[model samples]
Target: MKELIPLRLSILGHPQRLAVFRLLMRRYPDQVPAGEISDALKVKSSTLSSYLSALLQANLVTKTREGTSLRYQVNMETTRETLDSLYLDCCRGRPDLCTSYQQPVAPKERHMTDRKYNVLFLCTGNSARSIFAEAILKSKGQDRFEVYSAGTQPQSSLNPIALEMLKAKGHDTSALRSKHMTEFIGEGAPDFDFVFTVCDQAANEECPTWEGQPISAHWGMPDPVKATGTHAEKSLAFHQAYGVLQHRLQGFAALPFDQLDRISLQNAVDEIAKTSD
Candidate 1:
């Protein structure tokens, strides 16, 4: 039997260091020198050195002395042990809770409890990115998810470019109309199971925000509606936004909703952002 390397998230407490651990895991089985990890994560050498040192101390990662360079690799042995310990500690009764979510169930067979998740997508304008997301999820999740989209400052009409592309993808647009976020509020409104902001929050642009989403994250994408150029260039912007949303939605759709706790659910939603194209 293989011995377990002690795993402690407290040692890699900061988001930056935890990010470094994830980065190394993404490139697992291939050792990454400190310089490469620093460049990829945009952290300074001094700063990255500190993060790496903590990870090493926690035994969450392994280091190789390859001549003058110190290459780093995720300690898979430690990761496996830590996850096993976590499951033992938390999944005493729920076997499905700790099982991997990679194997997605078919729409008809999934969510056997007859639960239909209420999902909301938001942006400053209802026209483009949010619209793209609603259509994508409706198509991908089929009848399993009740998907809706709205804007902080609702537009009187949907973006024509976005509509054109949706039609190109063979998505029906008759039911999708631009609307304000308030419509979902007031009495007798469905409580959203998932809320996502699809606008470019990273640029500090004005995007919608909501409280108590249960599970929420910013799946931010550039506002293709703001793009100015030739028709083809503008179309390209919307196309890229569609690709990013489609990829992220695929991740969201595969999650085992019945098998996750609030902490696990929140982590899964946040991790889906990494799949951004």
Candidate 2:
């Protein structure tokens, strides 16, 4: 108790550190990049490092590596504990202020249930990125999601490179084909629970509004179709796209959808972009 007070006080005493902590708490529960944090707070990199280090030492914040990017988030448990300790001390002799202090409710547990979610992956040509995402998620989701892919402009045929890559990895390429996005929007189509745009072009293009107000996110990636140079280079680009989609889809499948509410699920989907290549 003697040692804890000063540790907590030292973290809260500095204005810059407090600002960074508060900013993280307000923006996202997942995590935000250091560059975004610094930009928003108008703090220099050297100075931000010192502030982040202080918070980290006090256990008020945590830093994690997502690929090559560094993400920071508030350590809510420690912050709550420190605040609770202070309130306890001040409320010992006072009753009125104590009356309104309620213990924070814990977040609900996230777990997968039997209910299957419908998801759509969209892209411009439905050739590489979206097709790969759909195939990967369908296999990895383990029948937990009804996965589909479509495009604004349907290709005459699926990209040969994407097909070969999936087949090499033991993914079934039988049912996969390029289809227009309008097919899903018309009558008798499965209402989607989640929709993700896997390329910048489709994400920006105007499209039919979904029926169920499904949670949507942009998981933009470089188009492998435009890869130029030697045959090996083009093949490698497709391989990399496949790998990136595999990583992203695996993370998506691991999410505890039954436990998280709509907003949390949306946030989780968006955070995947930061963690992926």
Candidate 3:
């Protein structure tokens, strides 16, 4: 007769189950819907539900009733224990491999006593990509970063498509305007930490070196305004550019600025710029 192990111990022994558990760990406390998990992992919903049920039975996940939808979140206490057990098993009694278990660190506080770094976005016309990036980053980055945008040769106005997209995305576009970069070059200009040129021409043009010697980067995105197609096609291009900028900026805000030297930080920013292309 085979010996029976405790349920918690038995669940930990299964590698397939552990993978699902780790997926939840990555999105912890977010209460993912089962359908999203199925879509993200390319698993059939029926099969995924069985796995989720097993996890629930093992107390590794908790399900909450959200109207007609069921939401699943990681049971943190159980998750910590499982991680502790795995760490011990993997280390093989090596103290160097497994340090004392500590509570996971929270995201760093955004409060900076030092003057906030000013970030400037530049392009030729500043009607589309540059405008979208400036608005999105300013709205989403909040207290973590200060942001601005200007054009080498200012446009008559902000792009209507860009303004509509921003409004659709729940961002306030009321205060946004198109302005010339020259306005920012004088003695009273706010010193910038980063100056990102969002178009190839503007990036190539010689400009005054910004005060504070801001780290410069080129994020060359194709101009959505140049799309020669149906209205839907032009709008789609703006949406795509917005998504690319949002993803890169979110990653930028999460960077460990304090821990990295100037060169390393520039490299990291450059790597993020590639994702937009």
Best by lDDT: 2
lDDT of 3: 0.73
TM-score of 3: 0.58
How many clashes show up in model 3? 0
Full-model lDDT, candidate 2? 0.78
* Residue 122 C-alpha lDDT in model 3: 93
| Per-residue C-alpha lDDT of model 1 across residues 128-245, encoded as one tens digit per residue | 8999999999999876799999887778999999999999999999999998888887567667778777753321232333333345666665689889999999999999999999
Compute the lDDT for candidate 1: 0.75
Q: How would you order the candidates by lDDT, starting with the best?
A: 2, 1, 3
Which digits, one per residue and each the tens of the lDDT, describe model 2 over residues 214-272?
Answer: 77777777799999999899999998888788888889899878767665776687788
Worst 10 residues of 2 by lDDT: 101-110
TM-score of each: 0.58, 0.61, 0.58
In candidate 3, residue 80 scores what lDDT? 56
Clashing pairs in 3: none
Give every collision pair in model 2. none
Ranking by TM-score: 2, 3, 1
Query: Candidate 1: deviation at residue 29, Å?
Result: 26
Spell out the clash pairs found in candidate 1: none
**Between 1 and 2, whose TM-score is larger?**
2
